[model samples]
Target: MPHAEAVALSGHKILAVGTTSEIEALAGPSTRRIDGMGNTLLPGFVESHLHVFSGAYGRKLLQLAPITGRDALHKAVRQFSDANPDEGLLIGQGTPYGILEEDGPITRQKLDEMEPVRPLILMAFDFHTAWANTPALKAAGLFNGRDVGPGNEVVVDQEGLATGELREKNAYLPVLNLRTSGGREMLGMSGDEPETPPSAQERADDIAVLKEGLRYCAAQGITAVHNMDGNRYMMELLREIELEGEMACRVEVPYHFTEGKPLPILEEASRMSADFNSDMLKSGRVKIFVDGVLESGTAYMLDDYANAPGWKGDPIFDTEAFAKAAIEIDRRGLQISVHAIGDGAVRIVLDGYEAAQKANGARDSRHRIEHIEVYHPDDLPRFAELGVIASMQPQHPPGTLGLPLEPGISAIGRARWPYAYAWRDIVDTGTAYCFSSDWPIVAVEPLIGLQATQIRTPWADDMPDQRVSLHEALEGYTWRGAYASFMEDRTGRIRPGMLADLVLLGGDIEAVVPDAFPALGPVLTICDGKITFEA
Candidate 1:
């Protein structure tokens, strides 16, 4: 009974973890007891890559474009418009290519009739493209058919008229601002309070949203998350949360860098990294976009798409510019995560990393290439040789299966298609890799991502050979993701002394049908010796 007398929470940190009886002995007379009921425990799960603010925003916005298809999209958008007639812009998010039934892109003319006066900006499921109406285009100063410049494009017709299809950051930023501003306004308008500019107060509200989202993640057993996008405001919010002792999850925030910007990189990085608290909130790495998505044919490609003839993909930054940035960033002892979906884009990133190494000797910088969807056979070994991590999303291949069907299969062709999710080959060659949901672009559920890895075949009966073992798939989500974020030593595995972040499943993963894993739900989610979520 003396053993039970000991209150075993070793001073706010897990002082000792043992059987209930052993732990009980350490309990003091005033010790509080919590019943475990023989439930399974695990280390908390960590999400390697995600846009936290955007994910929360998406949850608030119109869910017009479900990844399932276009009819659902049209119905959802129409319903939202019908209900919120006073809103200036009819906005929606998440529409993958495979879901659309329309032959061509979603045009402005189609959305014009619904609310011809109000602007409309419906983002593609991938967030790499946008479907804007004429009003939205005009509002964004992209009415005329012209190159909006760098990482942005306006899809045009034969006569050079804006087709309402905007690709990459070019078309996305303007509309993105409109959505952000508009969402804030909506939040203010809903209440009987005076609407002010989105000051620190608004951001505090957003921080509250983030905390709620983190709680949701913890309940699902996520212990850490690699936040792909977080600005100074977000960082401030995080600091506030930490100071208030409200921070419960470990977050690795990556600073974003654009091509032309030079001075801001060091200024921002130094400011952020100088004060970064490694305990729970730390700076992860720097993020850059080298190319767009493969489904949109905007990703830089070595060869032309089978459907879109005379068109190889587009690159956001030229080779020289990319190389220069990579060198400077690498020299600063910061990791780089570049978005490169196509083979050509991947090659360009590789070339940049190689240039950086040549300029400054080989360092332990674990530079990463995000979305290496298509890889040239020759460049497969470069990942391992250069020590680059392939940060990929498995759901893209299975989710975008209908891409070949729409816009003609000629663009992708058969030979190049087999190399989409080449996880086995990448690992065989000694390259490290990780997986993410790219949530809001796709579903945030890790099970869906794992399922895609196990069954590489598209919705149709194609490309079965690309499928990988379930263990390999799970590793990508758990261990590989941790390695990419540089948290391998602290998280990922369910070992003693690690943070008590773990998930309890309704059923064992090994016993369930592989394909049905996507439907599996978490029964409990624990984070940092606290219960975050309980089903």
Candidate 2:
């Protein structure tokens, strides 16, 4: 953490970092020098969790505000369906929590009034719950009310027919899987690979969408991304981008480890890891979902929801099953990152990691919990003890992004506010935590996350020391993220010989005053040896 006044770049590595005079001496006459104009410089942001293709796909769908009332909801749905007349399914994203007039989830019956012929699906921001029209339900072959094991429901009406509201991936994936080249990639479930890969033209479309998404990330100073989705289709799409020389930033896809999939999936994870082990495009990790998100009331919790008595949300994998999978994956040496949002879910995931350590012996396994949204006081120490990485998205906190207070905050109840979004708590307990956007779930801008990280009101009253300084928040988005992804040796620093990945802010980031970080962004972004974006 040296105080650097100037840095000299030699090819793709830093040649010198010192006072302005010392760095100037190393700069050759041919060097291209750009004055900072008083803006701060730092390593490019490393986004720890985002689904590239899914996000690209969401970019195409209609985004509805959670509270868009009944009439407006229908009007927008009809307009989108009419606009895309050729589309078999008129999909929508960013649907609000209480779009319908009544409480509980909006039913498919209501959607049918908007467009009875075309299939309609408006998914929740959390991606766990979705409301569909009758046509969409029939399209997924669940209109007859198909049962999908424990913890997943199709929301049948009193007549025993599907109501078009689906809960959990087990319920909605049936519809998503029907989309061409769309499947369990979002859930990170292994073996849901499409029976037929994307055709040449489809890959062309994928390339078009994904390349644009990558550019958007680069514009925000994102140098590297730890993509949370995995499947052979996405892997192939990224490979095509790298082969065509369209890759502008580093990308890594995980091996989605899901339930009911055999042990053979872990072996495929190893093979995929070895096949695409390059800096630009790679795969050497496994992603799992221990529970759903809190917004949907599916986030497994130790205590029952304040709204629902006698029941706490359940984990996707039973205790013994998770233990087995964690042990196997840990032994394989591939990194493990799980989506655990609730305190109960977090505890189980930690227990599984502890079991893996005991069974496979210890290694530098930087096992991660994707969203430790609500951490139990008791389980707070397990993260440090098991050497877990707390992968969090600051933007997912309540009272931001137009999120209503009910679902995200109230679902956990007022009593747990101190423990929810406990970034300061985890850091104080000596666990390494990294930040991500979880794009398509919230705003993707790291700047927005940084701004959200500063809000400690009410929460400050509960914890008194939950707010983080700007530097610590910046580190969570940089070097610590690199460390979480096992890429610290080459990236995430401005020292000599390290990668030449830097972002120049247009505005003076350090002088922006507290609570004004949301207004800042990069003016120029350089990745590797190339300048990817320039304002």
Candidate 3:
């Protein structure tokens, strides 16, 4: 059997897997063995896409304000400010509208009276929007009539004054920098520096945060994580961690191409790719952000948002430019992962991939489309036709549900709704799919994501029609996740010759009620022949 509860198993890879007595015959006197203690053993989970560092740091930085209503958020900010009198600024992240009572947008004036002296910046649950105080705006030099950046907008009042709400990076970047810089200074003063090289510290912190996130993942039986954020410093930090032998889980780092930039970074990325040792840390592919998110109304929609008419989502790069970049990257023998959320963005990404395929002929580039949330019905089959991997986050649908599904799902209509997660549909078409937490945006628990996949309804919604089978959900987190990161050969499965990464579940998932799977927590997580977590 691939996974067995009782064990006296030992080897670089799985030497023998069976019942305790059956496998004990192969063990020598010095064979190291671990008792499952009645836990259900399974292959270690793999996360297809996640911001490891950001998720880790978010745990320590700000409080998540429940967007129950305007009053609840206002009260939370006021209470937080009151609790930290000496704190320079108030920072809050992950404020989703599903929890809010107000249907309209949130404005900065709501919190003006709470603590105007200190700057405050609160990120929306989507991370695509920001609510900033006047002082914080001024600090970012966003006063007067300055334009934010492309794909971002400043929420202004009828009087043309800033309303404290910013959408996308255009408006959020300025304030985000201020918050990050300020947080860094605060961290520096606390003498809690975890790594070195001033330029590399941010990247190192991300890795440190990711390492901590791994603990949470391990608790859920995740043995491998595919990091999609690409930065020079991040690659270096990964190398440092691997050199020190501190890397417990397998990681595949993909480089992302910056918007409006040439493919020159690909050469540098290739150099880094050379440094990647497939043993533990490996360089898998390159990433590109073709569009924004659907919830924030910046996801580059073909049609306008149903709730907010006359607004089509923004595309980070025009179709021609995006296609050109894809061809160049693909031509260089590098795999590509594009972020396409809206239907329009999805169409654009597919067109680009098709163009790349036509130009370069068929190859095993394994180009993937990240966050394929809204897809044009016509484009669904093309994913499998082109051999593309749909790296999706199951938590998004449940987490962002209840927001007038029109703009995101209704735009595509009922026929496509059945294929939202579309795992069964996509697999039927021969396409590979995977699941991830997209942590920091959502929790990094693979089990939670698996729970969400099995039970598509958000925490508040008790709908049963949206649920999928428990077996399908687990495969998305395991084999599919490994395939998305190109680690299927060594990490996703528990077969012989594969890495000995596995997790011990508190209960047998197959025996649990389908609806009650979320309650099944992980008891132990093993990675690369090492036990990283036990609880």
For model 3, residues 113-180, the per-residue Cα lDDT tens digits are 65577788887666777788888877777654366556668877777778887877557666655553
The reply for model 1, stretches above 4 Å from the true place, is 1-41, 67-74, 98-104, 179-197, 399-410, 458-464
Give me candidate 1's TM-score against the actual structure.
Answer: 0.87
TM-score-based ranking, best first? 2, 3, 1
The parts of candidate 2 lying over 4 Å away from their true place are 101-104, 177-191, 459-465
Score residue 115 of candidate 1 by CA lDDT: 48
Which is the better candidate, 1 or 2, if ranked by TM-score? 2
Which lDDT tens digits does candidate 1 get at residues 164-231? 88887666556545553434412211111223545666777777877876765665556678777665
lDDT of each structure? 0.69, 0.81, 0.69
lDDT tens string, model 2, 359-433? 989899999999898988988998899999999988777765556776677688877878888788889888998
Name the top lDDT candidate.
2
Lowest summed lDDT window (length 10), candidate 2? 182-191
Query: What's model 3's TM-score?
Result: 0.88
- Measure candidate 1: CA RMSD: 5.2
